[model samples]
Target: MIDVDVLIAGGGIAGLVAAAAFVAEGRSVFLVDAGPGPERAATEDSDLRSTAILEPSIAFLTEIGLWPVFADGATDLATMRLLDAGGRENAVRTSAAFAAVDTGRPRFGVNVLNAPLRARLSAEVAQLPGVRVRFGCAVTGALARSNVNTVALDDGTRVHARLAIAADGRDSRLRKAAGIGVRRWGFGQKALVFAVSHPLPHNNISTEIHRTGGPFTLVPLPDRAGVPHSAVVWMERGPVAGRLHALDDAAFEEELNARSCGVLGPLRLAGKRAVWPIVNQLARRFDGPRLALVAEAAHVMPPIGAQGLNTSLGDLRALTALTRGAADPGAAGILSRYHRTRYAPVAARMAGVDLLNRAALAGPQPLRDLRNAGLRLLDATPLRRVAMQVGLGAPQGTVSGKP
Candidate 1:
């Protein structure tokens, strides 16, 4: 039997970060993934999505010695702009800009591409002492005992650990093996993700345009070959998104430019496009027995306000703090504390994002008008600062483990 202090199932960004974080605290860890390792995964053509690492997450990464890897490629997001273009002509009706200065910060966060960030984190975790990383290997099952969990691998290996973390994904197998249930619902909407280069500079501003189907967002990205570029997450109804994805490059660009309202002036596809179904999910509980769930395995929200991965990092932060000097990281007391600390906040955040997504899906003219009015009210009042703070996952200007 292979023995370790921690066994992490899933080698994605969250799992990698968890491994590094635990190892940094002087714990032995074994990380496993069903897919190819980061080296191969990074070279793939899929997963063109980008993540906005908010301030709190950045601090956590820096503490674990993983921030420098993403520093060079990170693009600052100094401001966030919201536009209501649900008008009949698909033209902008009302707009609001929230500057990071209002929050007493220079920038809300820095954005980085998903693949490269995963690769860099994987490399950093591998170099950390007291850690083992195995790609193309999976945790087939797990059995929890009084003091340790014995995990079964697909290769007929048995590993024992004081704690088992399921960072696998929304459909986590380890979560199921641990008998943890999840609440899930789909938006009947899909998001089209890709990178684009435009004639106008983004100026470090992240913009989200609200119309009939959903919000079309343009997040700042590092320049490519001296050209201004941004990552686009254009959300629409399933059929509409499907047709757009099936369209050829020229047709797609035409439709993209129209949806963008020419705000960036003739956007050109800078990378391959991918489509993702939208959904909001939360695990019924954060932990069971000698196991704990983190990241997508615990909670999942739409790609709005850059909450998905940032929230996952928040899980790592909370878990790290709760288990800092523990002899058994997965002790029932520790897991229970983790569950109590994380569940309510994550549930609340998921609810808020769900409400925003439903509003963005408003179809009728009157409903769209109502949504626009609400945006105007939020922008005009002091609620704007509160909104910005909530969007950053910092309630009342305080960065808590809730993140």
Candidate 2:
């Protein structure tokens, strides 16, 4: 059997980030992923993903030395503009200035494509002194006891660690192996994400224009061919997305441009469009015995308001604090405190995101009107703004940014 301080069962963004945080603290950590992740492509590469890096998430990553690597290749959104579209009289707009003045950051976040971020994170983890990643090794079995965890790899090797990190993603194998349960809810909506090159410049402002089906976001990216491009998360309700997915390029493009409200002056499709089912999965408990859940393994919500990866980054930050001063990386006392502090914050964010997504995606006229009025009122009030500011900075533990 092999030995390590902590054994992680996934090597995705959350797993890599958590491994880096522990390695930076001089802890011996082992990361095991079923297969190597994909590499980044040069121009307008979608590879089916994108995530927003919130201001506090950026600060936490920079503190742990992961941001520089991610930033080296990431697309920056220096500003963010929220535009209400459902044909409402308010037609409100909010910018980074709205989130930053309260949070003390220049911008609420930066938006970057997934492939580049993953490629960069993989490299950063490789260079960390104490992180050992074993790719192409699937976990064949797992057992957790009070003092340690034992995981068997398909390669016929066994590893024992004081604790196991479940960074395996939304449908986490490690989480299931430990007998942890989750509450699952589906949005009945699928997100069509792709890149679009528009005639007009994005002007570095990421826009979220809500429609009947759901929010259609145009996240600005560094220009390709000197024509401004943006990453789009086009949420479509029910069978419409499925039918559109089956449509020929010409038909699909026609329908897509019509929905854009002429904001980008005709959307020229770039990169392959991909669809993902939206699920809200929250582990009933984040830790059990010698195992702790991280990232999507802990909780998941619809991709509304820059929540997914930002929430995961926050998990890495909180997990880092839970293990900060322990002589042993996976001591039971440390793990219990981690479960305690992390549960509330993670759960709150999960619930909050779920609520926001439901409100934004509702079909009825009264519901849509109420949501729009709420955003407008919230934007106009000073007391509510300060309250949001304080809530945004609240952290689970030492390393800030979880919720």
- State which candidate has the highest lDDT: 1
Off by over 4 Å in 2: 40-46, 88-104, 383-403
Per residue, candidate 2 scores C-alpha lDDT tens digits across 98-194 of: 4454455555567777777777788778878878888888777688766678888889988998878888888788888888999998768888988
lDDT of 1 by residue, 1-403 (tens): 8999999999989999999999988999999999988778778865799999898898898998888976759999899999999988989999999988777889988999999888888888898899999899988999999989999999998999999999999899899999898888976899999999998999999999999788999999988889999999999999999999999999999999999998888999997999999989899999999999999999989998888998899999999999998888989999999999998888887887888999999999999999999999999887786777865558322643221
- Per-candidate TM vs. native? 0.97, 0.90
RMSD of each: 2.2, 3.7
- Where is the poorest 10-residue window by lDDT in model 1? 394-403
lDDT of 2: 0.75
The local distance difference test score of each candidate is 0.91, 0.75
Best by TM-score: 1
Cα miss at 183, model 2 (Å)? Answer: 0.6
The TM-score, computed over Cα atoms with residue i paired to residue i, of candidate 2 is 0.90
Assess the local accuracy of residue 236 in candidate 2 as a C-alpha lDDT between 0 and 100. Answer: 77
Q: How many backbone clashes does candidate 1 have?
A: 0
TM-score of 1: 0.97
